[model samples]
Target: MNKVTTIDLGSNSFRVLIYDCLNHKIINEYNEVVGMADGLNETGNISLEAQERVVDAIMRSSKSLEYDPKSAVCVTTAAMRLASNSNDVLKYFEKTTGARFKIIDGKEEARLTLLAVKYALKRERIDSSKFILLDIGGGSTEIILNEGDNFNSKSFNFGIVTLTQKYLTSNKLIEELDNWKKEINLFLDELDINLEDFTFVATAGTPTTIAAIKLGQDFFHYDKDEVNGTIVNLKDLDESLEMFKNSNNETITKLVGRGRVEFIEVGIYIYKAIFEVLEKNESIVLDDGLREGVAIDYCLNKSI
Candidate 1:
């Protein structure tokens, strides 16, 4: 059996997925909500405290792998990619644990997101000629417009943590929303892409939260395969947003799924902005994206 584990070190969270290639199943998975991207706007760098937390988390996750440490592949995304001293942190990890981590660029991020969406959907053929692939991470968002297998993807620097630091926490949530809306509208107009040209397929925590809200759950279990193509309407999104915004930190933290309390508002803003821009009423959620995309790439390359 080919055994492999892929780790995604993101801005707000670190995820590890250990796979049994022969069975095409996940054997072990762990997620750590470590907001490494926080305070970037103020510090202009990742804080040393955050760095230490991430390094410790990575070390612990790495030790959980059934295979050799030398065999695991760790990739860092937006947070590490933009941090002024990201290379230093990477070097530290390499020196301490002998784990080499690669920083993936936006294009690669978008491409992997596409692969993950397709695999999650398990669609052999696509009937729609035009569709949008979206992944909203803690520190960035990748938007892809697909026509069949060929498409265009652009990664935006905007994300929950960045937006929150700039807008929400400052008591300027409405102002930030307006400005973001205008920015997205300008971009869409420049691309000459109309709302009718595509159907939205979103991945990541944001979409999943929307799914839980749509299902009326304060706490519930969600399956990626089950919710991959789930559709949520504007009304449900609005209600959820209101509920989340009205709640205090403790309340939001207790809502459902781990680590959403601090950033759920940003997730809502993302959904609201996208929907408002497109003049659409709903978004289809896809549970599979970047992580599974990593899995697919590893399997195809027989990297294990």
Candidate 2:
């Protein structure tokens, strides 16, 4: 039995997972908020502080991993792609830990996310004529369009963390949510998507956390079985947002936890806008994403 470890160096967080490929099970997983894209919008470069934090997180997670780095698949996404000092940071990481990281571009990111979601869809027995997958990360958002078995995608630079920080000081950010919906509508139009005919499948932290909150799953104990394939209604989501608006950061943290609570306000707006533009009243949440997709690909494509 081959044990495969995959690490997702996400913009908002760093995650490491060990999977039993033959058995199709995750043996161990660890996720930590490294905020690789923290203040990136303002700086146009990855800050020294953020880089240090990310390096520490990676080192700690690597220490806990059971598999070899030479064989493990390490993926770096949005934040690394956009950062001016990405090469230096990556080289430092590789030299320090002996783990080589591959920077997956936007289109590839979208494809992998859809691949993982499709796997989840099969696992859950959800049937649909066509389906679309969207992942809202810290530094970018990827939308995958699926017509039958064929897939294509569009990637946007805006994401929960970056979007929030971009408009943090705007007085009309809250009231201008509808305007953002129009922008997304225009973007979707450019992609020539047939939104009316396809089911919406959402991935990433925001949707999953929302599903968890709605199902009353606390931060200490989250069940993927309950979250994956979970349905999210826009009306209910609005209610949750309103509740968050009325509460303090401590309260919000208690609900969705640290790294996400800070971005939930913006993330909710993005979700609301997309669903409204697509005329989707609800979306099915999927817990699996790029990490799973990469791990599966490595296992299947490697030499037997």
Candidate 3:
């Protein structure tokens, strides 16, 4: 079988995913929270402690890649892009794990994200000529507006972790809500997206986690078949918001796990804001995106 793996060095977590292309099976998958963006905003760099943990996580994930470096494609996102010390961290990762880490800019991130969205739509046979493809990550959000083959994408600096750090986490939750609303609204309004006749698709952890909650469990059981084409209406999203409000860290942790527990509430709100501003009714959820896009490129012998 043709095996391909993609490592996602995210702001909040590090993940390694391997797929057996011939058999269309998942061979190996691993995830760990490293809190890469914990103090990113204040220092504009990946902290020493977080950098240490990131190196450790990458070394652990590299175990599967040692045998054949050609089998895996590893990439880092916003956390690295904005960090002043990112080059040092990347060099350390490469030296220790023998993995070449690539830093993708906003447009490249969008292109790859859209590639994954197009792949999912084709694979699942979901019909839509023009739609928005969105990925909500821990450090950044990649937004894609697709009108047939013509598409445009922008990467916003605010994501679950970053947004929470910037505006949220306080006793005055309502006040924080209004404060963040103005900030995120400005960005969305500036986009001037007219999605009135388009479908909205959401990928990455937040949307999937919201969809997973409907499964009625605290532990997230990642099933792409279940999450890939799921539709999340704003009404269901509102219920998620209320549930988070009544719950504490312990309760939220049980639902979405660590590093994600606190950020998810704000993540959901990001979705709400997007739909409200874009004037879209619902968002279609996809389990695959950036990682899958990398895998697809690797399997095709194409540049990733």
Best by TM-score, which number?
A: 2
RMSD of each: 2.7, 2.3, 3.0
Q: Per-residue CA lDDT of candidate 2, range 1-304, in tens?
A: 7868888888898888887879777788888888889989888787888878877877787677655666678998999999888898888878867778889899888777776777788889996448877798998888777877787787877788887887764355655556656666676788786677889999988898889888988666788889998999897688888988899888788877777778887888878877876788999998898888877777777621
Local accuracy by lDDT, each model: 0.74, 0.81, 0.78
Q: Any residue pairs clashing in model 3, and if so which?
A: none
Cand. 3 Cα-lDDT: 0.78
The whole-model C-alpha lDDT of candidate 1 against the native structure comes to 0.74
After superposition of all CA atoms, the RMSD between model 1 and the true structure is 2.7
> What TM-score would candidate 1 get against the native?
0.88
Candidate 2 error regions (>4 Å): 169-187, 190-193
TM-score of each: 0.88, 0.92, 0.88
Candidate 3 lowest-lDDT run of ten: 63-72
lDDT of 1 by residue, 1-304 (tens): 6767777878888887887767667788877787888898787788888878887877787766544445667788898888899888888878776667789998888877787677655562334466776688888887788777787777788888788777745357667667767876676777776668788777788777678657654544555545556788878777887887687776676564566576777777787777776788777887665666677678878652
> Which pairs of residues clash in candidate 1, taking residues 3 or more apart in a chain or in different chains?
none
